[model samples]
Target: MTQDLFDPFAPVPETPAKSGNTPEFSVSDLSNALKNTVEDAFSFVRVRGEISGFKRASSGHMYLALKDDKAVLDGVCWRGQAGKLGLVPEDGMEVIVTGRLTTFPGRSKYQIVIETMEVAGEGALLKLLEERKKKLAGEGLFDADRKKPIPFLPDVIGIVTSPTGAVIRDIMHRLRDRFPRRVLLWPVLVQGNGAAEQVAEAVRGFNDLLPYGHIPRPDVLIVARGGGSLEDLWAFNEEVVARAVAESDIPVISAVGHETDTTLIDFVSDLRAPTPTGAAEKAVPVRGDLIGQIEENGLRLSQAVRRLGVEKKTALESLARGLGDPKRMLEERNQMLDNWADRLPRSAVNVVSQARARLNETSARLVSPREQLSEKRGRLENAAVRLDGAMKSALQMQQARLDRASAGLRPSDAKRDVDRAGKQIMDLGARMGAAVKNTLTREAEGLARYDRLLESYSYRNVLKRGFAVVRDGAGNLVEKSADIVTGQGYDLEMGDGVTRVTAGDATTEPASTPTAPTSGGARDGDDMPVDAVASSKPETVSKPKAVKKKDPQPKDDDRQGSLL
Candidate 1:
């Protein structure tokens, strides 16, 4: 007997056949045969081992190896079955998988095709739960600060639980007995496959409802379940359900299982209740007690207000008594006023008598106005006579001096001086006229030179040389052929006149015939046609007549003569 060295468990080969009776098999045929044999033999199995090399592919397929102290077995769970496995598979986690054994033809190896997988036992499940709790706690999901305060009295209370269970009924009955509220029941599976997902979705669904929508959104959420074993209540222990509770916008009251039954959700929820009934009680207060307290407070407030009003009235009355009588004071003031009025008229008559006597005495001591004026006129006549005598003496002295001075002069001397002044005036006027004539002549010559220079620089001189200035219809100078637009009108300015033309095909006729220069006598420089000058014979060309320059001589007119 010989065993294959590569595979210790492989079947041993029998003795060599004498004839060619041994059947030959290809690699694929052998692999398929082994796959069929392994599937048929272990069609259903449950394997218990520690997970190793666990990896989830991007395609959602999970690949891993299960190993014990002695040997290792490879396993694979397709995407469809992986989600239903309840717990996430991790490295070093002890698990139990149920599936069929199959062989891979390409690799020529045997593996288990897992359908369902779970933590191996209660102890293993507890270990996995503890590890998950530590991970979520590290991320602050279980912190007290992250938990929201539950509403004391919610208008709408949303509950997530199985519809057919007795747990929901107990909660509803308790709420009705205490303070009846509007309840929104979100039906979900409590335990089994997909139970965790349903519970998580129910929590998120209530939060998604709009506050002002047709259906009233709940103010608080209650997640309740009945008492059960650890395995039976495993759904609440799921990490997904715990995260959903932690992230809830509304406060949550966890009432899953009994008082002693703890799960991941209990640690994350805002509040925890021992039972479903307890959760309902925590949701709202008793209506009767609230009403009784309010009435008691109102009674106390009214009594305090009444007592304050009595104290204020007593204070006001005491202050009024301290004031004295107002009528007595007014009577005393009236008596004093009558005494002063009786004495005032007698004092006025005495003052008038004294003033009249003083006026009579002053008149007796003064002189009359008519007598004083007569004395002043007499003094004025005396001064006028003395002044007339002095004036006549001064006039006689002045007249004697004038007669002595006239005796030393002669009329011939006076006449000679007058004639000499008249001759000097005539000579000055003649010299002034000559100077003005010279200045006028120089100014006129300068003006004529400027006129000639301006004519030399004028464009008309170029026209006299047989050139014409062209301009567009808009009157802009056309210096280049590129500036001319086809089919546009143009003007040709010659020395004589401006002629209009149109730019068209090369063979097109002019728009208007240029008018022939008038056949009159030779014109002056200002109006002569340059074309006629250029066409004439050189010998017959007459020099342009000189422009008459204006004399700048000053004009004589009736005006004021110079004082000099």
Candidate 2:
């Protein structure tokens, strides 16, 4: 087998091309050698894999594991390199990491030292953005109610974006084309690792500006950037930037990219514009358009004023026609007064004359006092003379009868007759005196009873019976408790004196005897006497004591029942 070069077990003859001496190395030396060789072999590499176990250290260095279906690799992005990337690496996020492969000599494991990192593709970036959007949406960060209305015109507009970018240039150009506005520029990086933080700071800084400070505060705000790849425009999508936009006091207009590009800032902003130029248009109205609108309104106002003037003039003319002459009206009224004045004195004279005639007729019908008195005196005198004459005649007649009887009788008989006559006269006189005394006694008793009856009905008597006469402050008698209003002061008149007291809202009825119901109706609690209720002032009023029932007396035939 001269051709055993391919055979693994075949022994071959030694050749004469060998040096005897070789360099020796330790395990650490060998490891360092492999490390250098591997780092050099793959100096710059771009890898596409799903990121796993991504962690950012306190040192600002990012470490992660990148994995495909079958294998896994370790990767690290140092602080400087990490800061250059626009996107943050998230676990399970597919990414393209560009770096040098190197080994850690101590651990003897190889890893990629990432110089730059990006999402694997637009699809991967969108997927990550979608997941982030879902998370933020769950927190109600994208609520429509949070959106504020953009001002039609602002005093000053503050912009957070790159100062020298085309986005700013477009906004300024558009603003100049429409209405010029005062602008304040807060220069910030539009994309990259710290771009989100810069944008957030700029927004917060603008809000913190004072109106009276050296730099005037802006009335509205704009966060703008030109359209680019997802990686290039990703700063606007950061949670920090979105939160800053949402919490800004001033209304914010976001113009982040082309019309088709969507970002998180768009949802949280007060208004979203397709482009920076569009944002400028939304912020203020066109100068020419505003002038035309004002002119149109002025024309309408003038027309309205002219119409009003014509209507007022017509109303004035109509009013002038409706008004009669004031002098003529006054004359007519004066004539009426004159007619009444002329008739008044004549009518008064007629009334007085008729009254005088009636007075004369009435006087004639009346009896004069002197004549009536004289007539009465004459009648009295005539009656007295008649009475005296009749008495004398009767006495004389009696004397003659007596003389005749005396002549016809013996001395003894005459003496007896005289005695009998004397006895009869004495008896008659005694009887007259007794009757007069009895009549006087009866009349006196009647007068005493009449006086007693009068006294009983007197107000003094009523007052003496422990009853009071209540009167208001004005001295008007209050017959019922309802007559006294709260806060009013009244006088209570007892037999001895009057007392003034303030009235309270508590209502009290005069002490009423509880009568047994003939109709057998049950009495409710309200029907019970309020006298049982405590008095606010004990000294002013005494509570009513319940009266005990008395036995009924037998009815008298002539007795009249009186309701007391």
Worst 10 contiguous positions by lDDT, candidate 1: 545-554
The TM-scores of all predictions, comma-separated, are: 0.53, 0.53
Cα lDDT computed for each candidate against the true fold: 0.77, 0.77
- With a 3 Å backbone cut-off (N, CA, C), the pairs that clash in candidate 1 are none
Tens digit of per-residue lDDT, candidate 1, span 386-452: 8898899889989988988899789999999999999998899889888888888898889889888
lDDT of 2 by residue, 1-564 (tens): 223323343332244334553334466766766775677679999998999999999999999999999999999989988876767788999988888999998898999999877778888778888998998889888899988888888989998989996989999999999999999999999987689889989999999999758899998899999999777889998888989998998899999989999999998899999999999999988999999999999999999999999999999999998998899999999999999999999999999999999999999899989999999999999999999999999999999999998789688877999999999999999999999999999999998898887564455443343334567778776655445576666666654666665655223432212111200121122122223211211322332211111111112212112201
Task: Work out how many backbone clashes candidate 2 has.
Answer: 0
Return the TM-score for candidate 2, rounded to 2 decimals: 0.53
The local distance difference test score of model 2 is 0.77
